[model samples]
Target: MSLSPFRSALAASTLLAGFCAAPAFAQHERMSVIANGEKVGFVDVARTGNHVAVQYDVKNNGRGPTMVEAIELGADGLPVSWTLDGKATFGGDVHERFLRTATKAEWSDSMGARTATVRGTGLYIGQAASPWALGLYARALLKAPASTLTALPGGQVHLDKLGPATIGNVSYQAYAISGIDLSPDLILLDDKNALFAVLDTGGAVVREGHDADVPALADLATKLTAKRYAALQKRFAHTVDAPVRIRNVRVFDPVSGKRGEPVSVVFANGRISGIQPLDAVASPSEALIDGQGGTLMAGLHDMHAHISLESAILYIAAGVTEVRDMGNDNAFLPDLMRRIASGEVAGPRIMPDGFLEGRSPYSARLGIVADSEAKALEAVRWYAARGYWQIKIYNSMNPAWVPAIAKEAHALGLTVTGHIPAFTNADAMIGAGYDEVTHINQLMLGWVLDPKEDTRTPLRLTAMKRTATLDLASPRVQATIDRMVAGGIAHDPTAVTLELLMLSRNGVASPSVAEYIDHLPIGLQRRRRQAIAPIASSADAAGYDGAMAKVKQTLKLLHDRGIRLLPGTDDQTGLSVHRELEIYAEAGIPIPDVLRMATLGPEQYMGRDQELGSIARGKIADFILLPGDPTKDLSELHRISMVVKDGTIYFPSEIYPAFGVKPFVAAPKMTLPAPTPKLAGSGPAHDAMDEFVY
Candidate 1:
């Protein structure tokens, strides 16, 4: 149905008449906010006179307190004013506000102020708007062309009506909204165009009276998003019909930890078929490529990534072909894996990690949360049956329960890894059966935190300052490292993850991402430079600097002691991996060793060494072509010219543009070489080259 301006006018007049007079009949809608099948918050909507008002209060899953957002909408349904005021994810402050005027709009948040010219009836979408205002936005977009909208201060939103779904005995039309940076969100409205529910793969805001329908509704939301992204997968993936050949490439040999001499590689059926010297002859039918004598290394692996479609694409564009998804929305992760496997989307091969958190008010809400040891064990078993590579325990988990959970996970053949539970130390976890530890902070916080400090709060991130003063040579610190070395515990320090938390200062660009800052969106570049943990005094700044320095020192110690380190990015996808390796190099690890740790180490840990981790004959064709030798300069890893995953070709230039990222190089176009001239003093050019193949 087209948006009838006259009908909207009539509806506005009717709402004014009814709501202004009776007030109690002010078209109200309310929903219970749910995550992990638990009710943590609620959303209330009310429209009166020529205005619509919505109030949302939800204690998000894990570490997120009760966050509150309020929106006041004008008669045209555009936001007149919006304010998000509360701590949500990771205890980040949620003081965001947007005000729209007749000719302009302005917004202010932790990132600072943004102003944009308003044309016609402009809209304002706050960061907290997803899964809450999606319904309201859907209703407003009925009048928009192509159900498309240009978001305020910049960006765009493309909305799609995904037919109808029934929740709680009521038939409602569902719509999917994309282009929000986060995952696609699903919105539902009743026949009368009344907001019914807003849902995502993890949680939902549904009508208060129909609380039992949230799960099914949440499932519907996941399927709807999957369907949408599957369509995108078809559009983005590129596959070749003929055998492909790449000539003149110096391949990185993970086993040798060095770049080999220039060679030509031929691959088909998603496996490397042969590796010949650069002058090797190629058939006319082969899809030939000139590598320009750059480095071709095994596709990189990120051991500690939180997966998302955008992040997956970004990873591939940066030459990362595989990822170990640390924690995510339970239903969404499996569905995403299916999409990538089926060639419905372009993404890295995912190795799943089951996330288990303890039930506490401050619990981080990404995965399953257990309230008891038995429940935690059950969660572990649940993941084991589904083939999870590891089980990650998080804050809020009872430290006492770690032994039982880890024991069962180990018995079932899953590695146990996680943050040091709140009020617990790494010594206890390592003793209990932790095979790996994630995040450098989670590993070191136990030494710095007061016994009663709750990691479920910001203290986990802020307590690192004490590390600056920590004496690692002391028995107390050395014992922890000793235990890790003795127990063979692997560490994914994610040192780069702490850089922003510790070193980022107000108004200063991140020294870490300075080389590629211009390639990102302005808002992101601004936000990236902002401090995550504010430094209140010079002492605090010094403390943070000391803490960061100490982290590198600890990393060097771990490396020197033969403690395995897995390179992973808990930050942005592709570039963050580069930054992670860069930090690894700064931590005194040689560039070759860092590359080996990033590529071969994780593969060996995952037990895929026989088939992966290098560019060799008969191995999977997953590798990236860089513009320069990464072993000579680790920074060259950031400039991925092309990526080949399962024999599907993707150019960073082509993929970057889709995500608004400026490509670092042009797409590699295949050019059949001219017939080889007679080799000087040689019987045949091909004869000399074939001698090196064996």
Candidate 2:
């Protein structure tokens, strides 16, 4: 996953590559990182003698703590050395070091040792360079005239000048820096080529004096990225193609947890129209495509997605066709949904979930922040008026006020789900009218914590170590389970998060990501191998193992009691959801049941079963065609041949390259009629596998 604002600030400062700025006199340049008008962190830039230095310091209180980075550039404005020493989102110890010389560059990061030869004037550095590096890199690119430069650890960096932009009263020259993922990270420069501001996907970084201008600048950045993705969607989505009929595929029955007999499924105009016997021949007018005896199943629903347009595309490419956004920047989520709905971008259908939290210094800064019961009710009415299907409470919320908040939300027809507030337990929230609990940790933490322990800190996570010895049959645990069962309370365990937190050890590749990490961009792949929680000794490792086992045991018990389990990845998008399902399977839930939880379970919970979550005729044509049956081995879901979302086709092979990922499979070969009309692009114009654009 792309780091959160605080992690992004501490992780890598140089997300944009190849751009260089003009040399400036020795001075300090301070930029404050702001999210939703709240200051989360800051980056400091300075040039002393012949070296350019950048430093970042931020403590997101409950979120990202102990994030610090130091970077130094050579006289040529290229990185000479850099290090990011901090804790990852799940509290992993991050110690990334990079050193460069004239002939070679060396790096020791989360993924271990890596080296690359010096090619031309290109600098091989870690991705953590500062925004100031953009202008300096631009200056270098202007002189060299190269489209891409190789990074030391691996991957190509593409840079482009987007001309000029004027935010508020200030004028600026704009440039886009991207490395894989088609992320057009736009950084703005003043007339003197000084790094004035950087607008990333969700938030922004502006000079300290310009803190108030973050919203406007971030909006501009969001639009530029949107336009870039819009062009990509237009170029890749296939809407004008002939009706597609996929024949000779086994359909997965979520109801029965088995694959039905081979069948022919045909759909167009965004709705399934027919399901014929596998032996039936397609009409001459229909475009017949061979499934090669693959399995066809409904596209998945990510019940706890904190969505972004980029993640949305990744989800669709990974066969997750629907998402229910758990929490996000109030300003960003609505517009992103609007773009997706208008077909200006390619993504899964989104169900917006309003995030409600109490105002506190350690509060998660997204969503509506309320300080009193009246304000909480006001937030509920606001979300209801705007059509939010559900409201999610957060850690800093007052336990005493949850009843009133839940009552107002329920009265307005919104389902209530969220973290059990600090100093409270799952049973208290369930009794207060919460219909669901958000995470497995939230449900289990109460059984282990003292009444005074505050969850608004890392203690909420670290306290999980105590769960290793928890007794599920004890009155304390059984009471919560009994209440949840009787109240029809659903659980969005986000089990992969627990696995990442408790089971991952430093230097040992996490099993949850080992299967697909290598397929991601180098930056992400490297980060995935790092531990989330440091294991100090054999006892610590054993504690982690025991803690993870208890959580798995909790999941199994909840399922046995008929408490609904909704599979969701609260971590990164795409393959993480796949891994979440695998965690479920490891918890002893059958493969078919896991698949059902990802597909039909959330749909039924959200009350959208009539229009989605199935492959029957009249349902929305949202499903994936995989090369193997997932019923036998859930891993087959990763081998997606094609994903049809709302009747539009997307090929993972074509989309992967945009993000610097090697395609997992060859684009499906298609049989077309004579005089094949070519797509407007150059590389391969034969419409490989009928590649479509939105």
Candidate 3:
């Protein structure tokens, strides 16, 4: 231990020589290149009985030299551990992490997750969120998401529906998805190929569809392939270019009144590249409007929408630009969001909320109700861990448990909003720290003003004079408003549903009805119409209608009283969301204000200012162009002829535009001659293409 000077010098000299040689050795690291451009190099831990038979695909991108790396094996020659080797054949690390998945036993048992390695393609397993990936590999492998990526130029990547697979120790089923892109978290791609894109922000994932192609889209993609595709390789690069111009339009500035003058809106590099002076921002890239004046405004936004792929089509067809889904179901929320963002699904931008609800034995679809503060905190943390935008509270939550829930949600940076229990009104909920209240009906159900007004029984409560409609002008209403102001609680007062609830059984008549309903396709119309009947003039129906109307008016009154009203439609589809805007107008709210509700209100509520809401510079390109000015008549909302959700233009009118393929020829009504000689070809398997006669 004492005489070490000479010994230390020799040891240091040996270590220095090793360090210098290490870099040189790493430069020649031996590795094997399997398929898909994956080069794994690693040392052999052990060897098998027979020849080392390794099967893998080779992906040659027509560039880059072939690289060979060590591919570690598991039991039965499966591609288990993989690493990029440096220096020698069985060398040092070269920066590659192949997560080992778990067995299926863990998944089937108590653990909700399991991981297993995929044999053919390592990619299917590597694309999962880390935890899920880890859980999967260490556990079992079931199915892998389909690896095919198809597109209409620039679109989103969805978890293609996949079939099942079996690992050595476990089995699983890979859930499909639409879109996934997250930052700051490892994507866990398990053996089942479940991928969770832990997003850095809450944004809609939208997609276009299998409809006819847009010529302009072709022009754009083909035109900018190089610069744009490079951007594509980067997650947050500026991906789309603004078209030359938008022609022939009416304009509705959310700040402007209805029946306002026409104006042109122009966009460039994802901004109001230009709002042309008063008229249309006409350019050769776009077509001019041929009809008389119509309404033009920013596209509508649905605060809450759910699972239907049809909902996305309905939203686009109806011109709803954005949709904020309130709950998750069917593994649908994430996939739906991704698809929308990817342009794989023709739909609106989606904002998703991990399901939240009162903890109950009856788990209603997405119900996750909680009875304790600790549970609420845990729930918030769990959702935040996933990529949910907000904490959507639900009905039947215990009043006493609200404050604890609110505290936990706020701590985790989630906005809490939903139904308040009957026993506790808006004041109690907000004072307890609720950030927002959804649906206006709940606001008026309180018994504060008329303390002795037989509040318990439904009949008694209905008969009471202190209904929300009455309380709107009372001190109690203002008090609630003051408290909301103090607590900064916003209201997602859905106008259309409330109006429909009021006009519940009016034989479904009204000219404005078509103004809203016309946006929907015939099939959707047929379905909604079916819900209209078996009409009977019963007092119960009358009272329900009255209460509904009162609720609508009550919401309007709240709006009148300076409460920031967010336009929300608990519509499963986008059809009703746009209608809600018009309904808000019918209730005497200004047309400009209606636009603001869909734009500014919810944006403010989510506290996502830098990226969303206004059609301003630097905000994510999410807006619509109208053919007419909606400020004149809310019906003009129907004029959303073009939409740019997430900067990609979705022109509905031209989605299936004629490509000069064929013209319709009306059949002759006269009795046709029977069987014109079975086509003289002697029927030798004639080709359908050969049948054409110009």
- Which candidate wins on TM-score? 2
lDDT of 1 by residue, 376-437 (tens): 99999999999898999888899999999988998999989988888888999999999999
The number of the candidate with the highest lDDT is 2
Better of 1 and 2 by lDDT: 2
Model 2 Cα lDDT, one tens digit per residue, 459-572: 777788889999999999999999998899999988887787677654566777777767877655555566677666788778778888998999999999999998888754
lDDT of each: 0.73, 0.75, 0.43
Considering TM-score, which of the candidate structures 2 and 3 is the better prediction for this target? 2
Q: What is the C-alpha RMSD of each candidate to the true structure, in Å?
A: 8.1, 4.5, 22.8
- Model 1 residue 615 lDDT score: 86
Ranked by lDDT, top first:
2, 1, 3
Model 3 residue 392 lDDT score: 75
Which digits, one per residue and each the tens of the lDDT, describe model 3 over residues 1-694? 0011111101000000000010111112111222111221111112243212222211111111111233433443333444322211111112223334433111110112334433332322221111212222211222333432221111222332233322222343323222221101112222434321111111110011211222222222222322222232232112233243444445444554443444445555555555565554354333122213444445667886653443455566556777777764424456556655665556666777755555443222252445676776677788887767777776545667778777877777777877655356778888888788876656666533333332222222233222423646668777887787677677877656544434433224332244544333222222222212112346544655556556656666767777787777766445466677776776777777877887756666667755666654455666655544555565555545555666555554433111101111111111111222345676544222212111
Record all residue pairs in model 1 with backbone atoms less than 3 Å apart, i.e. clashing: 61-365, 62-363, 62-364, 62-365, 63-362, 63-363, 63-364
* Model 1 lDDT, residue 186, Cα: 60
Cα-based lDDT at residue 467, candidate 2:
91
C-alpha TM-scores of all predictions: 0.85, 0.92, 0.54
Number of backbone collisions per candidate:
7, 21, 77
